[model samples]
Target: MLAGFEKSTGKPPEELSLPWKGMPDLKTGEETVEIFRSWRPHSMLFNLPNGNSMALSHEDECPLHPRSIVVVDDVYCIFLGMLLENTCDLRSHYGLSRQVTEAMVVVEAYKVLRDRTPYPPDQVVRDLQGKFAFVLFDARANTLFIARDRDGCIPLQWRMARDGSLVCSDDPNVIAEACGNCCTFFPPGCIYMSGDHPLNKIRAITWEDDEGNISSVLFQVDLFTRLRSIPRTDSSANWAGVTTVDGE
Candidate 1:
């Protein structure tokens, strides 16, 4: 993956760029027939957040037939993109004043695409990712998410695409250009958000697993917790707190 993130971070993958919107299909003069039988060198990308991409292979091994290793670099990706292009050019050419600089560490590391409201109402502004990543999209929560690298070396691949898209890739020519058929691999850090496409809603989450499920949590205690902390105007409150109408 970008020459093992440029040999474990020496830095140099076209100075880097995946800010979010998609771009990285570095194909030049024909590549890939690799089912075996010599011919290697590859990488293709796109993940401006919604463009959705990934396909990088670099492995050609054979140390006296070490169990006939067929293309030994099965994308165990640990991308650092060259220590993030030398810490984003040393925080923009040594200006680093700090507000968590490096442009707010690349915008608070994609701040849940702007404070999380969940899925495509322009998914936090149509996604757009950065930092040692993996991204797959069906767009506007059309399902199939596969983001990556919580620690896992970037190996990725996911399924669904007989005529239904919801893919993820690390080289089957990006599943033949977004699901013409190639789905399956993204086992990295793990971010697979799938209801299982084709207009997915398949319920069965059956009440359980709540550890960040704030139950729409609200906590206030000063200035009435900054003005009655929560209440988006269904407008009804009595007991001397005021505001109660309905024929009052």
Candidate 2:
């Protein structure tokens, strides 16, 4: 994964800080937020179930493209970048007041995809037109939905820590420092959903412009506890053929 990441990002793995061979004392959550404070002033950390954690932060440097977090009905979302289309439409569709933030729109969208739509998660993601990346955690359901824009307009990366915690961030340096060569870029145009619900799945999707080709790949943790990607094709008869895992 690191080799592929370096090849695509043009950043050598050796340049990253020494990898943490074992777990550091990050369970308290404060230590993890501090790592991000070096880059942004505003930071918040959420301690997730199963010893997992999420840290979000952003600066006031770009007012036009602001970062936002919204919690509604036990669903928490952190969004970066703008939803150029369907922001208002989604707000109206969900009967959300105009005062609601963009993060709320994302939460409603996820709910629709998870509960209402028969379309695959990747299909809903592919229809979205914007430069954005978001992480939504449904605390009540113990599920997580993460996605990046099709063009890779916003940065996002993830890696499994030595302690088996999943770490994700927009800053590659932070991810590199924590997981070193183990880190990899969260593939563009991919949606990763993991939950106890039978309908949830982890899918990494790709599309080619020249031929309008589309493909889907499933991500699974093998018996050896290694993340592996298996290529798959779309089947109308079994749209939800992929498997899902609980929050690791």
Candidate 3:
């Protein structure tokens, strides 16, 4: 399973780190055996493009809540790390008049996707108060979306495969094993989407401005359309000062 990554990254098997809150397990003389087993039962693996794959896991004792994944129809969503419910806008939106659990939020997100809510996914994400990250994949549409909480309390990382597929997970070591030095942290307060071009192409749901600061104003308009208007620049500098909406 990791052979492709090992051949591509050239870091060999010993240097690799297990994805999430786990470590690589190697026997004597650097003989690779297995990856560190996560204490959290919610950990899972997913198939990515170009034969690549991704995984999500968390520390059972360290994290406030266990991570989880929910699949609704063609959409698969994974929620990792903790959430601050009091800061979440559950009462105002999604018609959730009562307290919510992590599973409830997952269901609501699935509903939003099924209903094709008029609002951008980022808006829904903005209303979610948490120190976490999520990856949503629409199998039928071949679209992959990722989002991180504003404070970035939880970590998410990604690396491009030799086949140009994007492999993302919450573990930097997982990325390191796959990408070597090519791995990087996913930006906070931003929604990343790879539409149609799910293999290697990804664009931030953001607009460019002279001040090098991203303002929340763009959230009021059609986000995808806005992304279309802006020129496709590969530089991350354009993402500087990008702002995300805060819930009331």
| lDDT score of residue 83 within candidate 2 | 81
- The best candidate by lDDT is 2
lDDT of 3 by residue, 1-248 (tens): 11112222222211122221122321211111123223233545555443423345544324464567666565666777666764356645666655665545755765675476333444345456667777665565555556676556666664333432345556545444444444445556666544211112223344334865332111221334322222322342332213332210
Off by over 4 Å in 2: 1-34, 37-42, 60-64, 117-119, 123-127, 195-248
TM-score for all predictions?
0.21, 0.62, 0.55
Q: Per-residue alpha-carbon lDDT of model 2 for 188-210, expressed as tens digits?
A: 55566653222333333333336
Q: What is the C-alpha RMSD of each candidate to the true structure, in Å?
A: 20.9, 10.8, 11.9
Model 1 earns a TM-score of 0.21
lDDT of 1 by residue, 1-248 (tens): 21111111111111111111132432211122222112233433323233233334445312321111011112122222112335654445435443333223333333343244332222211222333343323333322333343333434443332222233334444335533322234333323333311111111111212653211111111212122212233222211112110000
User: Measured by C-alpha RMSD in angstroms, how accurate is candidate 2?
Assistant: 10.8
Provide the overall lDDT of each model, using Cα atoms, as 2-decimal numbers: 0.27, 0.52, 0.44
Query: What's the residue-level lDDT of 163 in candidate 1?
Result: 21
Q: Candidate 1: which stretches are off by over 4 Å?
A: 1-108, 116-133, 136-160, 163-165, 173-248
Q: Whose TM-score is higher: candidate 1's or candidate 2's?
A: 2
